[model samples]
Target: MFRQTHIRLTFINSIVFIVLISILGSIIYFYTDNKLYEDVNQSLLKSVDHYQNTDGPEDSQGGKLGEGDQAPKFMGRDPRILTLIWDENGNLLAGENRGTMIFQGNEKLIRPKKYGTLEDVQVEDFSFRYVAFKTELPQVGKITVQVIRNVNSEKELLDRLLLIILIGCGVGIICAVASGYFLAGRALVPIKKSWQKQQQFVSDASHELRTPLAVIQAKTDLLFRAPQATIQEKILDVSTISKESRRLSKLVTNLLTLARSDSDQLEMKKSTFQLDELLKEILQQYEEIAMYQEKTLRLEAPEPVAFLADKERFHQLIVILLDNAIKYTKEGGDILLSCTQSHSSISLKVEDTGIGIPEKDIPKIFDRFYQSDKARTEAEGTGLGLSIAKWIIDKHHGKIKVHSIVGQGTKIEITFPKSQK
Candidate 1:
């Protein structure tokens, strides 16, 4: 589809450019031709004017003569000129003898009023452009003068210019086609990257969700094997199965949310809400879970901080961060939540005294299904908590970062624009 569209657009553009160039070239050609004709006409008129203004009769050696009987002189002496003069009786008066021979059988050449200017005519074997005009003598009879020249050179130049235009346009079209292909390919690179990421996301989601499902299935089968067992053992097995099932369900839900976010199908309702209040609410809900695991959850915000955002998604974002902090922190470790607002943006920080991530793993910790401890498969997460948190922040037009030191702690800082609601 993209290829076809690009080609169609390029073709249309090329046609438009070709038409414009052709129009401009034609305008230039005709203008140049008109100018050439005007210059030639002015030169011919100047020659005629000089001939008409000559004063006296012929010299002793035929040096100069009056306009009535004298032939027009070629000041530039160009060989192309073919001049002629005739009397009223169809007899030759002066000028080139070739004109006399040509007009000997044509009586139209002697008529004063019939003589035309700059007319196309054929004499002998050559085509010529001829101009004829008459001037009356004081005492002698009327005489006609005609000037003729060839037009083959001008036609040759025009033909060469048209050939050049054709060749140049062909080459320009070829280059445009090549460039269009390359530009379209470059523009689609981002789409190709997004597609590859989506494929990886699908594969990772399947692998991560399958593990908890398999655990739940195995635990359920063990419960069936011991139908006659004690109540305590059966209760323990059922509880384990239920926990794994819940874990798998949460993973699937997060996966769906991430997919919706990626496809831009998730709708968010924007409103002004208190960020500190939202964080406090999430902390209170997760406090029971933290206490059950023998961990301490704390909120460090000294005052209320307000922000513009989707209240529900903002709650989910805080829940994800607090859950992660509790999961990674050891029993009796500290988990802190805090928020600060500035003129342009606001920042929320979640710090935990946990088994901090390694330097290399920290960079990819937010990637789907990526965990720092490869050998610690006993952990109960599908490894999508940070990924989901990151997606939520991105959808809100915010940024998140992590600072970690192995065996020391990890701190996650998220910043949201004040106007991004």
Candidate 2:
């Protein structure tokens, strides 16, 4: 699914970039073509203007265009300029540079019915821009003046510019496709990770819920079969049902908490509290419970430390660590809780002599529903306690570190700032 999405995103991005590049290339091509064509037109019109101002295409003595005596008068003008004239009867006249030009055209090219507007004439292999005009000179009546200029240089330049624009567009499109694909891949990384995490979370939650549900259904079947059994006679079955139901309830509650945390909806109700006193109270409550489980629980918080934090979440965090320690420790194992404070920060530690976690498993212990025991045989927890504890620590802007040696012991230390923003 993600692979398809990545390709789709890349394709969309590349298409958009291609469209923009095409528009830009077209604008450049058209603008350059217009400018160069305008320059050629201006050059052609300027030649016609000069012809008219210099005696109206006729000798000053009222002779016809291209008379033998008019040759020396235009010999020094632009060599690319070609001047030709025609009479009302369609007779052709030539100037000095007319024969020098290599263009050959029929009557329609020379005898335009109008003037002042430039037009293109392609004669064999040569390109020319020309303008024709007719006026009654002093002696020649209705004589037409044709001014033509060679524009091969401008044509070559426009063709070269078009080629360059096409090449640039091709290169730009390739780069757009490559970069679009690369950036789209980068963008999907986080989304892919989140999707996988969500799938794992749902699978683990379903597995956790299924066990208790199956037990509850079997116990319910037993109760229904013995409808006349006394409450005392069926206490053991009832107790089993109750135990599984409580476990199911706890699992649901943990799932809900984790879901809220994932969506960032878990609000922190923070307040300044005495850290040492809270630890003392928690230790006292768990003291007898640890003794019943045949383990020793102790606390070493000698000073009062006021910390700004979410008090309820802080309590839950400590309880989670303490419960995990008691569950894993064997009979006569020692569990220690300590709180130390400085002016700027407060530190808390939970140490236990338990069946220690492997070093390879320590980093992943806080992952939801992850058990250190590969076979998952211990079965003492829903495996979400440390995950929730990690969330609570993060919410309070705290740092936690785990130190454990296999077969020896495990210790978890946490440090938090005195004030939160």
Candidate 3:
């Protein structure tokens, strides 16, 4: 699915690039072609203007000549510009022409209707641009002067330029395809990771919900089979049902907490709270439970600091930390909670002499649904506590640090602002 989406994105990007490049290439080609043709026309105009303005004639023909004769002047100029003079009787008179005899057949070129108008004529493989006008000369009867130029050089240059433009566009399109594909893949990386995470979350949630549901169904089935039994006789089954129901409720609540967090719906509801007292109150409740599990619990709050934050969120934060410590610690292990106030901030640390997490797993412990080997095998948790705790810390503009050594212990320290501005 992601691959298909990436390909589509790349295709769209490449198409846009190709269209823009083609338009730009066309503009360049047409603009240059127009300029080149305009330049050739300017040269032809200058040659025709110079011929018409000649004062008296050189009269180099001498003698009386034909009745329709004309005296010609020899003024050699650019070899590309060709000149021709003709009489009214359609006879080729005297003119200047230097190169390329490809322009032939003077019959159609001597027409009076073609006077003063620039025109193009294709002769074999050559292109010619010429202008014709009849001028009354003192030394020669009314004769038409034809100014022509060969534009083969311009044509060749335009052809080369067009080839270059086409090649550049081709190379640009290739680059667009490669760059578009690479950028599309880069853009999808985060989305792909988010998708994988969402899949894993759903699978884990289903597995967690199924356990309590299966247990509840089994216990209810046994109760149905023993319909004749008294309430006292079915007390154990009822207790089991109650316990599983509570566990399922807790699981659902945890899932909802995570859902709210994911959707940015969890409200901080911050207020001023006594940091030390909240932890102390929480520890008092957990001390007895720790004793029951053959573990020792202790607290060390050096100063009573007033912290301004979401009191309930801080409460949940402490609960998650202590619960994580209790679940991961072995029997007879010790759990410690310490809250201290420095001049700048409030610090809270939870240390446990538990089956500690491996060094490699510490970094990923806060990822939703991520569990270390010890937690998966030896503890009962949905593996979302640390993730929620991290969220709470981030919301309160605080930082959390975790340090754990395998088979030894783990320590978690959190720093919070004394008062947010």
Candidate 4:
């Protein structure tokens, strides 16, 4: 599918490039053709004027002749310019043209109309520009002077230019296709990764949701088919049902929170609050659970350190960190929570002497649905807690860092900006 996408993108890019080059090439071709023709026309007009004046009769003192005078001493005509003259009686007179002999038997060529300016004409083997005009002489009747200029040079140039344009267009389209394919691949790398991630997320979410659903179904089935259960048995069954239901609820809530965050709908209610108090309050809630597990839970803070941030998200952040620390720490192990204030930021640390994560897995722990090898085999979690924690801290314009050694301990430090107000 991605290969097809790349091909389609390259094809579209080639078409656009080809169209633009064709337009530009046509404009250049026509403009150059016109300029070449204009140069030939100007040369023809100059030759006609030279013949009309220089070849005429001289004055009494042997000076130049004026207009409308017969030439006693005729000047030679330009070799590139062929002149032909004919009297009103349809007989050739005054000038002979070797080039015009190609149209000797053609009546239209012998008795052509006055076209006033140079016009394009074609012969059997050559192309020419001809102009016919009638000028009266001193003693002779009206005679037509037809000037012909060869245009084979311009034709050859235009042919070469056409070849160049075709070659350039072909080469340009080839390069466009090659470069477009490369660029499309570069552009699709990120999109392909995003698509793979989305697929993985859906599959993982389905697997996680299916576990609780299966438990709920099995427990309810067993309860409905029970053989005369006592009150306490019924109560135990109800407790099991409630536990699974709560687990399912938590899973769904996490999924929904992530979804809202993806759609940019997680509204934050920002306010100034005492970080120390909030941490203490959250730690108090987890202390009993830690004690039940026979782990030492501790909180270290100087005084009431005020900060500006979303209160509910801040609470969630501390809860996630503390809960993870408690879950991973063994019996009789220690979990420490600390908060400190610097000149420009507030820092929080959650350290636990638990089964520390492997060095290679530390970087990927924050990824959604990512579970380290040890966590995957030994622990029970939705694998979304740290992801949520990271997202919350990122939204608060903060940073989180993790340091761990396998089988030793793990320390997570989060830093947030202080309120200027």
Candidate 3 wrong stretches, greater than 4 Å: 20-24, 27-94, 99-124, 127-151, 171-192, 263-281, 284-288, 291-311, 338-348, 374-378, 393-400, 415-421
Q: Lowest summed-lDDT stretch of 10 residues in model 2?
A: 68-77
By TM-score, the candidates rank as 2, 4, 3, 1
**Every model: Cα RMSD to truth:** 7.5, 5.1, 5.6, 5.5
Tens digit of per-residue lDDT, candidate 4, span 1-421: 9889988888887778788889989999999999999867776777667767754423323444334543322222445666655667766543133455565665354345655766776665677777767777656657676777778898889999999999998998888788778877888899899889889989999999999899888888888898688758788777878988998898899989998987899977889899899988998898898889999999999877998889898899889888888877789989999999989999999999988888998999999888777533355788898888998988888988999987788999988889533
lDDT of 1 by residue, 1-421 (tens): 5567666766666566667766777787788777656656665555555556664223223454453335533332234554555556655554544534555555353323445466665544544565677766555557666555655565566668777767776776676566656665665677667777877888888788788888888888897898898868688778888887887788889888888877789988888988888887788888898889988888887877878788988888888888778878888899989898888989899999988888898889888877778564245676787887887788789988889998878999988899974
Q: Decide which is better by TM-score, 1 or 4.
A: 4
Error of 1 at 329 (Å): 1.5
What is candidate 3's lDDT per residue for 1-421, written digit by digit as tens?
Answer: 9989999999998998899999999999999989999977888787777665655223234333233444332332445676666677766664333342333354464333477888877666777777877777555667777677778888888899999999999999999999889989999999999999999999999998999899999999999998999989999989999988998898898899989888988878878878889999999999888999999999998777789998888899999999989988889999999988888888899999988888888899998878888434467777888888999999988888899987778999999877776
Give candidate 1 misplaced runs (Cα > 4 Å).
1-174, 218-233, 376-378
Highest lDDT, which number?
2
Q: Model 4 clash pairs?
A: none
lDDT score at residue 225, model 1, on the 0-100 scale: 90
Question: Considering every candidate listed, which one attains the maximal TM-score?
Answer: 2
Q: For model 1, which pairs clash? A: none
lDDT tens readout by residue for model 2, 380-411? 78889999999999988899999998777899
Report how far off residue 185 is in candidate 2 (Å).
5.2
Q: Candidate 2, after superposition: displacement of residue 99 in Å?
A: 8.8
Against the unseen true structure, what C-alpha lDDT does each candidate score? 0.71, 0.81, 0.80, 0.79
